[model samples]
Target chain A: MPMTTAEKILAAHCGRDEVRPGEIVMADLDLALANDITAPLAIEEFRRSGAVKVRDPRRIVFVCDHFTPNKDIRSAEQVRLIRDFSREQGIENFFDVGEMGIEHALLPEKGLVLPGDLVIGADSHTCTYGALGAFATGVGSTDLAGAMLSGRAWFKVPVSMLFNYRGRPGEWTGGKDFILHTIGRIGVSGALYAAMEFAGPAIHALSMDDRFSMANMSIEAGAKTGIFPVDEKVEEYVRGRSGRRGRSFPADEGAEYAARFDFDVSGLEPQVALPSLPSNVRPVGEVKGVRVDQVVIGSCTNGRLEDLRAAARVLQGRKVARGVRVIIFPATQRIYLEAMREGLLEIFIEAGAAVSTPTCGPCLGGHMGILAEGERAVATTNRNFVGRMGHPRSEVYLAGPYVAAASAVAGEIIHPARVAGGDRPGEEN
Target chain B: MKIQGRAWKFGDDVDTDAIIAARYLNPTDPAELGACLMEDIRPGFACEDVRGGIIVAGANFGCGSSREHAPVAIRGAGVRAVVAESFARIFFRNAFNTGLPIFESADAAKGIVEGDEIEIDASEGLIRNLSRNETYRSQPVPPFMRELIASGGLLSYMMKNLNQEGKKK
Candidate 1:
């Protein structure tokens, strides 16, 4: 039987072939993880299993990325609990803020993940690893608790949604806009319980980082996992990063996809998701001239050095609007250090953007960049659900880093390509 | 193993936050949980209906957050079985490990309306829609999962069996 990338991964992991959608499969987990935010509950549930020792401590990684810098006493206590648990459990793979970055970036950049592995994390963006051909997805704290206890979790194979993107993106359009536009068309929860397989020329031309950005937002559309077939681009990235090489796996020719969508990338533009939902999106041009109170260019969604550099390039020698507080937090410490080393930090600071430490700060309202009642902010984070970051009355506008940076300068939603700068307006620089 | 009850149905994408939002993550009250299940997304899903029956849902049911509270809330609200066209990867396993019977029927939510009487044969993973006079086959419960539910849950089963082995020594 012809199998999609998802089916191939699940089958290989579970030691089965031709697994049916909606059928429970006892797949082996390649990697399991929890972070400070979810680790406390997971540890509690692990203890409830009554096991004197973890099934395999080495397989687990504990990251302190969500509320880094000890935002509050409660957060500090939570981090302390995780530290104690790691030390007590003898899990030396513990990563505190100093050593950690965003959970998804830290994992792959550190060579902890490889192709065809089935990994799980406590954060929804865990699906980001699928860019490298892994079937990685998120779980709740309790489900993570169960995995830590038993080392395995059950699954119902999902149906598949195949997205075919052809041609290149329009000027000023980046990976962020691609995903936003796709979600806008499909709506939030459109790919519910289905694996999204991204294929076609446009997808093939995208860099590994771009693909990572694409797969990362699958959960926003409620997909089980988003995947891409392993190819030379992925192989080159992984091999260069870790000095590790692995074979690529593409779907067998003519693999069956439950549903397919074809898009012309050149027609797409910078997209923005309005408040309260990821699906509430419109072309950036349509929403242009709208004002913003703050601009956040961070989170696991778009906090890499390239992403920061993209924003920095837009903000250089420009001042943020008087009332706009622009904050830029890199996804991981490594990315932050890289940005600093590359002098992007200087540009950000000179542009009057607050360059916070690496953490999931303000992404989930854990710390930093939170808005008050009737407040509004433009963010590069994933979800803009009501009360997600702070007060229920606060609204978050989701946009690409470039657009966010431009808006930080204009104090309204504007295309960075449109700004008077080095790159041409709407240029694919 | 057999599970018989009335039925409660939900649509797709019943997220973790909806099952139990992040604000209430710290609580231990499962009873209080039943009231809030689907409160944000489905408003009245857990309260007015969904008593003493199976839950049938469309594709991608229980898709978001892996909070086991979702299944806990369902079971706590007196649900016996969850029948869905498909389930999110983690939620699927969480239900079984916690002793909540979840069955998958491709026609999962078809013709099985809100107030249907249903009987589930866990051994065969079959659902008999008594109200619709239709019988459907579900995804088979694996052997280990059967043992888990039979022993009342993963923790209980492990405690009883493993602790007994210690006494045998």
Candidate 2:
């Protein structure tokens, strides 16, 4: 039987030869994750289940990424609870402040998540690991507790949608632009309850960081999971990191799909999701010169080492515009250290940007770089919904790192191509 | 099961962030979270005389963030159920897991207005607007889901099943 990549992964995990869409199965998870915000409640539920210990402590990870460094006393208490529970449970993968990065980026960097793994996280962006050829989906803390207690969780196999893209990205157009354009074309709920299988030559050309950015925002499209096929790029990345070949699972050629979309991004311009909805996308040219008070260049969506280098190329030897506050957060400590060693941090700091420790701070309005009432910001982070960043009246414009860096220099949203003499837009400098 | 309540209408893409803002996430206590429910979008909706009401919303309701706090707040605020044109996937699952009933019916969402009296027969998947004198239907709750709700949420359901299995052993 022909099976989609998601179906194949589920089937393998469930000990079945094949599984059909909408069929319920009990899937063994390779990893389950929860952050400070979700872990407290999950721990409560896990204890309420009358379970003395996690089914497999090694398979569960607890990270204090959200509200890390303790936003306040309450958040500190929450982290303390997670720390205590993880210590008592002997969970080996617990990440504290210094060791913590955004769980999504940190997991892959540490080789904790491998290709074809089935992962469930309490955070919505857990699907970001799909970039590595994993079948990962977000669930509530209750579901996370269940996975912890039993090492298994129920799943309804989602039908598949094929997104085939052609053409290489143009100047200032990278993964963020491609994903925003795709989301714009397919509204917010376009792929509801469906597995979005991205393929075609364009996808094959994307680097691991680019693939992670593209897969990160699948939740914004209401997808059950967004996955890329494991190929040479993935194999190379896995080998470079772990000195071991990564597993690969390609979809059967004749697998059925609910819908198929052909996208040509070679000529696509830089994209920006306007205020209120990620689907309300417009070409950067149309919204260029829209004044922005702040610029943020980081998140699980685009906060890889490569993303920082992209921003650094634009900011090097240039100052951020007066009165525009530029903030840069490397997604994880590892990425932060890499950026420092590569002098990207120096470029950012020399350009009048404030650099902070790796935390999800200010992305979800947790802290640091939050917008004031009626303020507007251009951010590399995903999601531009009303009140997403801070005050209900503030607005966020979603763009790529190049655009974010350029906008910071110009004090308004602008295309990176317009930034005088930057290295190739998406290339590491 | 039959439930009747006054309606509270909301617009499309009423996300989890709006339903329960992140600032108030300190306390996991349902009542504390419920106090600020929709406070950003509908200030005082939770604390006001809106108890035992039904939330009627447009498409893609509860979109954004996988926080169970949204449904927990709604259930804590005494909302009997939510009827919307559609729902985000994680929100749909979280609602059922928390025993917060939700139904998707485009006609019902379109016909209902704030303060209108509404009645729901969840098992039979029927919705009736008493003020508008209109009736709408939604996909019936699956038997397993109904059982989860009847057992007062997933934790309780799991506990009951675990206990039954132990007794059988």
The model with the greatest lDDT is 2
Per-model TM-score versus the true fold: 0.82, 0.96
Give one digit per residue, the lDDT tens place, for model 1 in A203-277.
888877778888889988888789887888877667756544554557777887788999898767788999777
Clashing pairs in 2: none
What's the C-alpha lDDT at position B50 in model 2? 74
> What TM-score does each model's chain B reach against the true chain B?
0.83, 0.90
Which ten-residue region of model 1 chain A has the weakest summed lDDT? A420-429
Q: Which candidate leads the pack in DockQ?
A: 2
The residue-by-residue lDDT of candidate 2 on B81-157, one tens digit each, is 99999999899989988778899999998999899999998778999999989999997666667777788767766
- How many times do residue backbones clash in model 2? 0
CA lDDT of every candidate: 0.77, 0.88
What share of the reference contacts survives in each candidate? 0.20, 0.48
Candidate 1 deviant stretches above 4 angstroms = A240-245, A420-429, B1-64, B68-148, B154-169
The ten-residue window of minimal lDDT in model 2 chain B covers B154-163
